[model samples]
Target: MAIDDLLDEHEQSERVRNWLKNNGAGLIGGIALGLALIFGWKWWVQHRDQQAQAGYAAYAEAVKAIGGDDLKQAQAKVAALREASPQSLYAQLAVLELAQAQVKAKQLDAALATLKQVAADSPMKPYADLHAARLLNAAGKPEDAVKLLSSYDSPSALEVRGDALVQAGKLEEARDTYLKAMTGMDVASPQRRIVAIKLTHAGGTPPGSAESI
Candidate 1:
């Protein structure tokens, strides 16, 4: 019985030692992995900030050049920034600004081209498309403008497209489009009356026979 008791105690000691030995490796590994994750996150954040700062700097230089009426210089700087950091906010804004500068220079074709490129490249394609629609309208391509505006989700574009249709002499279509605009807005009485006149010319009856817009 004495020998049996000694063996049982030795077995208990061995079991405890084994448990500690196995669990020690796991505990140390878990701590190391947690520290690595924390440091990795910090490094990633710092890198992203550095890239953003660089992109903004390039964009600012472009804007300054544009303000100085040096459009060629501005275009060069913006192109470089966009090429280097296509996904940056500054890159997107730079393109939009470049298009505006081109418009001011009476470079309508250039502006339209730049806006189209931005529309294809940027995440804010709808905004670029809106500007492109305006450019098309100003360029005397009302049909093209109407088509592009029709593709947008914004209701204001509907009004714009309706105006284009009216100018293009598609009176029936324009009337339909204008009524679609009045569907959601609080049209003033005077505007409603104007719409009624337009509708009558377009071979349609106005709401309430003389309703305001």
Candidate 2:
């Protein structure tokens, strides 16, 4: 009976040792996994920041090239940044800049196309729409310009719409639109002068300008 008791005690000790060994391994594995997750998250964040920085740097270089009046080189750099990070803010801004450069180079069709794409997009839709409307107005499509500007509720859109209405011989509507724009205009804002001019041309007196009704 004593021997049997001794054997039983020995078995219990072995079981306890095995259990301790297994638990120790599990604990070590859990700690290692936690560390790996932390490190992995940090590395991912660093990588994302690096990508963003590189995209922004490329955009800056493109801007510098533009300042040097090297439109072709600037376009190439913008293309590369766009390809590298199509969803980045820098990429979107680069596209807008490239479109403007195209306009400066008198590549109006390309500019219009790019601006149209941006206009239809959800992220930059307002800006793109405004630019597209401006270009359209410059291209002598005042009615289309008005339609495009009407899509946005911004003060600039109101001013643009007023200009389009005036150009289209809708003087009464133009006067009303100009008044809405004038509500937020300061003296330094070109809209102030613009609204006053339209009002005078529409046979109305400008509030701050020395002009006849």
Candidate 3:
């Protein structure tokens, strides 16, 4: 190389060394932080997946025990799952199953208490409330059932509320609730037909029915 070219190359090398000397610690720290974040994310994902798997396994055991008529074992498995992973979907399902088993055993009060264990913020909470309302209605607490379902406006909720109203001797409100329940249901839906029967029994005419004409 010519002298000028060699001098230029040496200047560039010196500049690079100076830059490194000034920023090397920061550069190393940035790399370490990046690697730590990457590994930390991987660990979090793996831990989450393992917890899900464990919850699923525990739920399966609970279901198997329920199927085998071993209520004690089923209850134990469900308790373990709930204690270990209370917020998990599998834990919610297992608890629901336990409540169902309790209901089938004619332990209505126990079933209601079991249903209450479901998280209020869970997606399954509405279903749990519906079940609890039914139990209350069956236990001759129709007014309580109506109060329990007061905040819900879903079709199923409305229908259950109507039933509770009817039992509570609020036929007019029951009919109104049944009409609301049938609002979006297809004309040919079996559920609509059932609701229509309830409406008629409540001394109200079902809309679109011959009596309503």
Give the number of the best model, judged by lDDT.
3
In Å, residue 85's CA in model 2 sits off its true spot by 1.9
List the pairs of residues colliding in candidate 2. none
lDDT string for model 2 (69-146, tens) is 777787688778767776777777877887888888898777887666442454877887788788887888889989
| Candidate 2 segments whose C-alpha is farther than 4 A from its true place | 1-33, 68-73, 117-124, 186-190, 203-213
Off-target runs (Cα >4 Å) in candidate 3 are 1-7, 210-213
Per-residue alpha-carbon lDDT of candidate 3 for residues 1-213, written as tens digits (9 for 90 to 100): 776576777798898999999999999999999999999999999999998788788889889987777777788888888899898898899889899998989989988988999998899999999999999999999999999999999988999999999999999999999999999688778888888889999998899844352
In model 1, where do residues sit more than 4 Å from their true spots?
Answer: 1-16, 119-123, 186-213
Q: Which of 1 and 2 is ahead in TM-score?
A: 1
Q: Write the per-residue lDDT of candidate 1 for residues 1-213, one digit (tens) a residue.
A: 576576777798898899989898998899999999999999999999998788778888988987777788888888898789777778888889889889989999988887776636567677887788778877888899888887654545666676678778888898887677656455565555555666666666666543633
How many residue pairs clash in all the candidates, one count each? 5, 0, 0
Indicate which candidate wins on TM-score: 3
True-structure Cα RMSD, model 3: 3.1
Per-prediction CA RMSD (Å): 4.8, 6.6, 3.1
Error of 3 at 119 (Å): 0.8
What lDDT does each candidate get?
0.77, 0.77, 0.90
